[model samples]
Target: MELRHLRYFTVVAETGGFGRAARMLHVAQSAISEQIRDLERELGVSLFNRENRRVRLTHEGEQFLEDARTVLDAANRAVTNMQRSQRGELGKLTVGFFVGGMGPFFSSIIREFRRVYPGIQVSLVEMAPGMQYQALQAGSIDVSFTRALPAIHASQLRSEPLRNEPFYAVLLRTHPLARKKTISIRELSEETFVLNDRRYSPAVFDKVITLCTEAGFSPKIGATGSVSSGVIALVEAGEGVAILPQGSRILSSSDIVWIPLSDKDAVIDMVLAWSPKLEQPALRSFLELVRRRRKQVGI
Candidate 1:
């Protein structure tokens, strides 16, 4: 009938006698008998054949005994799990990232979290900002690191600003503009630029176009792709120059040079965003880790 009833029934079935079950359950023999009778009555079947000397289970009782034990065991485990979750010890955490630059920090955070909370499991998904937002909205991910999220996606999520990485110009090592430590907007006006399509990373693209226009010339566009990595590869091949966040590290190559853009406001925010619907304990722990490491990244 209730959790207590199943627990009392299972104990009696295991011990095979009310007197012994009562002792094992820390209840009086009469109280144990009454609870087992109530469980049988609620189920509409006799669970045990009564005898002055020994007790045996009825056919229905044998099947019900197994079910009862299973229920009791599961209930106990649920309680234990919830208690651990409350202590930030046991749970699942799902996180999404927009770029690979977080690889080292994320790995360190995961190792530390495991040492501190061995019972929790974490899942990490890396995707572009738009896909990460959709995953958060659909309840597939709990938290994320993203850049240039739009107002529509921002409405469905809570974002915390972590750091700002200013724009930098990427060029082949032999390119003329690679000579400057920082180039003014006016200086790069005549250069051909390659980048992700406007629809892919709109905020950055719009700013780049506006800055170029404000500098008094339209950009001589060379190529556009749908991904950041693709844009970087094209820049590497000397197809065109590119402006991206300084956080976008250029790998070791003989032909690539990264130089900062001189505009004071030319920067992209790296932020932590999450759906408003989630308040999972494991997610909270992960956010704490992100916050700690974001500072190390100079947020």
Candidate 2:
């Protein structure tokens, strides 16, 4: 039978009379009586014993009342949970990041988001810039924090620049230029330059090349690593010098020294990228939080 049938049966059972149930439900007594009769016919069981002035529930009616209440309670809870999900109050959000992605600023934003939406499950996946873009496009990750890539020209994806910081020259401690507080990109023309593979971050690789070219010399490619950390390790092993984002100083090594680049163009942009096609309440809430955080910091 329908939910209304169960409700009408329960109300009549509780009130002990058709007239009282109808009045409580704001319906005609005759309407309640007809619905109850319909319920009994559907169930093939008499639910109530009607007397001249009183009504009493039969054995089957008493048993059915408990099940009806349970079913209604579960239905109500399901509706509430659906509403919560739609409002971005609860769900899972998969976030992608590259090496050194947990810089102070990015980590702070994540902390604040967790504080605000504790019900949303946030998980992190470490990937290169190229892989992050691919994952985002493939719907494997919800959003990503990565360096702005020139190769990511997908129309379905949107990127928002969050931070722009200069690059630093990473060199072996024994190198004479390592002692300098800052150096121009032109001074490194004679040295072998270690760089991460273009597949890791084409934008960063291209930026380094452009900066060196603008300084009247193309970078002498001495070595290449798959990721930023690997490039740093290669530098530590004296493979060659490399340029890295300023924030990468946090991944320092005793054998390596980070010297700031004098060229203003030797910089990298950190951005948040996501696919517009997969818009959802949780993603929207997170993007809004990012905007609010950026405003608070005057970024």
Model 2 CA lDDT for position 173: 92
Which segments of model 1 are wrong by more than 4 Å? 10-29, 38-71, 86-88, 100-103, 250-252, 292-298
Q: Quote the positional error of residue 47 for candidate 2 in Å.
A: 3.4
lDDT per residue (tens digit) for residues 1-299 in model 1: 78988888888888889999989888999998998888878889999999646788989999998888888889999999999898678888787875533546556777887887788887888776767778888989888777756888878788888667778888888887678888887787778889767665666677788778777789989998566777888988778988877656744356788888888777777777888687677777777776877677775
- In candidate 2, where is summed lDDT lowest over 10 consecutive residues? 147-156
Cα lDDT tens digits for candidate 2, 65-154: 888889878878889879988999888899998767557767887898889999899998988887888888888999999888565455
lDDT of candidates 1 onward, in order: 0.79, 0.87
Which regions of candidate 2 fall more than 4 Å away from where they truly are?
52-54, 151-154
* Model 2: residue 145 alpha-carbon error in angstroms: 1.0
Residue 150 in candidate 2 has what lDDT? 66
Top-scoring candidate (lDDT):
2
